[model samples]
Target: MSIAEQFPYKIELHVHLDGAIRTETIVETAKRRNIHFPWETIEELKTHLVMSAPPYHLGALLEKFHTFMPVVAGDRDAIHQIAYEFCEDCKKHDVFYTEARYSPQLFANKMSDGSKPPYAHTEGDITPREVVNIICNAFEKGSQDFGVKVKSILCCVEHAPEWSNEVLELCKEFKPRGVVAIDIACGDLDPDVPHKELHTRAFQLAAQYGIHRTVHAGESGPAAGVRLALDEMHAERIGHGYKVVDDAELYERCRRENIHFEVCPLSSVKTGSVPDDLDKHPLHRFINDEVNFSINTDDPIVLDNDLTSDYEMVMKMGLDKEHVIATIFHAARSCFAPPEEKKQILAELVKVYGEKYMKM
Candidate 1:
């Protein structure tokens, strides 16, 4: 096998739980629930789920999950199974450590307003807290079963002020139970229209309680979105911050603060957040500008990408072996895993990338 194939000791910081659903799980779960999906077979399901190349839509980013909501939004076992399979899939793909995220608001009784995640009726009686516990416990089982390290982060939707507060409370209550940090995700409006009042309150609680902050900014939104997330909510890490390269001041501040960028190259292209053309992607600029970043599969199965594929993509896009390796280390540092776990993964990375392991 080539070095790319043998590339060892991976870490991811930006994968979405719902966005990364396994097609087979989606198919089988839908079948059991009598829920209908557009495709009949796993092979056919991949056509709608995976983004082979770009010219993909932003609506397609989370909108593809409309068919998936019935299973996830309704059932605890379905959520647990999905979380377990996500870790299993990461281990099979050679990821040793990872931080996964999800928005809890989407699950709790979907709304009649403009709010998303249409409520899917469930025969089972389950609250969102129970749902969170089920998902977290399933991650623990998957870690034990697959020998991969996984941590969960909860997201509060940008526009859902009330739900955002509810999700933040969950983050505080579940911090010791494998939920590490809080995130505000999925606002793609212009930078000037800040989603502040409720998000700020939630983040203040995070600060008081020691929950780390990661935010989705500068994605489909402009570079100013990155600055707003920091200024308004104190974002410690940015998800899909390619637009930071477009603004010199933000670039300099990110470098000085050691703010990590969770760069999901494939998702960037597919969501129209960055260019469809890989060569034109600002990952090159992030490299040139010395911004801290970690390559990630924002949605693995959905985008037809995993950590290894992203490693190959970056290498082909002009990153050398050292940068390719550094990205993993960057993720290790920025990951929400415990300090000792972080140390172990870093040591393992050194051992694998070191001459001793390579020679062996």
Candidate 2:
């Protein structure tokens, strides 16, 4: 059978909730709030959010964040809409199970007027408790309505180290409601960003509370960032460790430790974090080294790709069908679910695709 007919694939470990907002949904939400978006068309919206030229400097990042912020803010209805829509999209992509991450604290606030905020607001301005509730409720509803399962991971912004504790505290409270992990996201440019100090505290707290830990590293920075994430931050999984190939030792350490790299192929290429050419992606090196990793579309809406398309990219890069199935199973193994649940999902995947495609 062709890969498309493989029926089902059982995992997606890396997806950003805010980044998955549909372009038209953003436009509609903005219109409802009387907030004027800069773009005239959905295509323009997609470009503004995902396809813009970038070294992804602070200015560009802020601009992109501002564009999507309105869609997620305001009342619980907006949050529910975006979250439910995300699950719908996941079902379409055949993502049986997923771990979706976002900074819930960032989604708080209503538009006072059409004008933008003069400066970024710290976590002090928003109630973390309310943000977590909004996110958890949406995820609960999505599962009930669509039969697609998801686990929410509260993500702390790396640039805002001061808010790390508050974010972790919120994650602790939401753990009973299916919030499974905590992550540190945002760019990794400044060498002295205090990622070590901040993530260390959060990781320790998560460990104490028995929640999983992950962090974004090496996507936009050097290979050393990946090492720091593992060594200093105690990250259980590394999000987009694209530069791991640059450090043989770190790559080996990840393989030995069984640390999963949530590699977002489309996002990496679109954001210029990886080479524009798919063939040049460090994923090839990861495959050769047998490093533990999984494919994801970091921002399906923004990157204009999905899990299926990500898999197709791997195939296009000449990974054979066996490797493709193995890659899918690798992703299933990396998910944040409990061990028993993961085992069940893995079995289901094997039953569906393994036997038929194993020798391909």
Candidate 3:
């Protein structure tokens, strides 16, 4: 039977909030905030958001993405709305659960109207704490409204080490509100910055608070990046760990350590972090090695994909159905949610899929 004919199970672990925002919503929010968008139409804006231009470069692509952020700037309500939309999209893809991450520092600013008090060392603005609250609040509401479980993580953009500390503080403050993990995300083209310094600090802080840690490594960097994140940062999971396949020792280490990799197939292809052809992806090799990993849509908006499409790609690539099921469970095991929560979700997924597809 074809892989799709056998049915597939899925769970997502590494998605970004800003990159997941709906393009239509971006336009609407821009209009509401009186920010002018360069695109004449929503379709054009989406094209830019997804980087449809031939021959993509990470730095230049990110620069283009920043052009749309002003609309979301100083807008807590818009952030909440975007969060809701993200959960709704997850549900549409049959993703029972998701752990979305965002950089709180990016949204830590006063309203465009400048009504609220300013944060320290800046003109009147909100604090990173405020941004975390807004994001968590939205997730709470979305979970309740959609019957789709969702949790969030505060991401520390590795480019700025000073700002990373602020994110760590916010993560500590929001621990009670279901913020379960801390992530370091940014372009890996230039490894000169040494993620170890900040990641080690973040991991130490998370360990102090008993929060889980994950890091974006090995996507566009050398295989050593994966080793550093695992050894130095002590990450519980590696996001977009494409380079691990290139280093047998690191791959073996990951297997021995049972480290989870949050693989985003479409994002890898779009960004040229991996071969565009699905058949060429090393995910099959990882699966065969029994490497614990999960499929995810890193930036659903930019990749125009979700958990369903990610699973579809696996099927299209000829992955075994039984292995797909096993991977989903592996993903559940790797979730940063509390053990009890993970158990409950796993049981629920097994019950549903087992009855529909796995039963003899």
Candidate 4:
């Protein structure tokens, strides 16, 4: 059997909703929304959207979001369609459960007061809160229709800490609707952003109120960012935390705490976060030390990959089937689903992969 077939069940903790929109969906949505862009055909769009080469930095990769985001952003139907389709796509990859994260602000075109502009190109009445509502509604229908469990992590953009408070509130408001956590995504870790305090305060509130927290740190930035996330934000997990290996003390602390790392192998190389040489990847050290980490496809639409692609890359990096099975269990344990849902997921995983693989 193929590697993917051998591991029939899988779980992913880090993927972006905006970054995973179907190319066909983009094409159809753009045409309906009357949005204009460079590429119209799917093949041409792939050439523009897919990052086929390595050594590209995170900022350059993120800029690509603007290219198509305007097409679906703020359109209620488009938002619902994409969220629902995401569940279907997850099922296609044999992913039984996944958490897709995105900044609601980026998908909104106006503020709560019906303001003129937000992140999308055209201004409209859609607000970030409304965006969440739409996605949650669609996720409910999609999960039932597609037979895949999908949840969301609302993001606090690093550059827009002002939005962090509302993001926290949204997490609290939508917890029952599959909104499991709040995360900080996008932008570099710059000290000069005076309003960065907003993110910290919001994260603190999230902790007090029991919201699961994850931060995007130490991917392309320094390991110090990872320390900041833990110290200030109370992050239970780190996103793309490859650089944590740079600090011996912090790495030891993380391993000791069993802090989960959402490791995206192909994305690490594609974003120039790790060396192109697979042998020199930080994941090797993670495996040797048995650190708590899970494999994921960070942005399949942009990276031109899927869960299968990430699994295949790790296998090519010398991981055997047993290691693959272990990571699935790692993800299942680290996921932010509520107690009973998490229990059910764990039971299903053990039933498929066997109890022997759980402790690995």
TM-score of each: 0.91, 0.88, 0.89, 0.97
| Model 4 alpha-carbon drift over 4 Å, by segment | 113-118, 188-193
Residue 137, model 2: lDDT of 81
Q: Per-residue CA lDDT of candidate 2, range 238-348, in tens?
A: 888887878888777788888888887767776677776677888888788777788787776656777777778778887777777777778777788888988888778
Q: Give model 4's clash tally.
A: 0
62-155: candidate 1 lDDT, tens digit per residue: 6666766666675667888989999988888888888789876565444423244444564334555666788889989999999998888998
CA shift of 190, model 1, Å: 5.0
Model 4: lowest-lDDT 10 consecutive positions: 187-196
Error of 2 at 207 (Å): 2.1
Best-to-worst ranking by TM-score: 4, 1, 3, 2
Candidate that scores best on TM-score: 4
Ranking, lDDT, top scorer first:
4, 1, 3, 2
Mark the regions of model 1 whose C-alpha exceeds 4 Å error after superposition: 52-54, 108-117, 189-195, 355-360
| lDDT to native, each model | 0.78, 0.74, 0.74, 0.89
| Model 4: residue 288 alpha-carbon error in angstroms | 0.2
Q: Give lDDT: candidate 4, residue 322.
A: 87
Alpha-carbon shift of residue 201 in model 2 (angstroms) = 1.4
* Candidate 4 lDDT score relative to the true structure: 0.89
- Using lDDT as the measure, the top candidate is 4
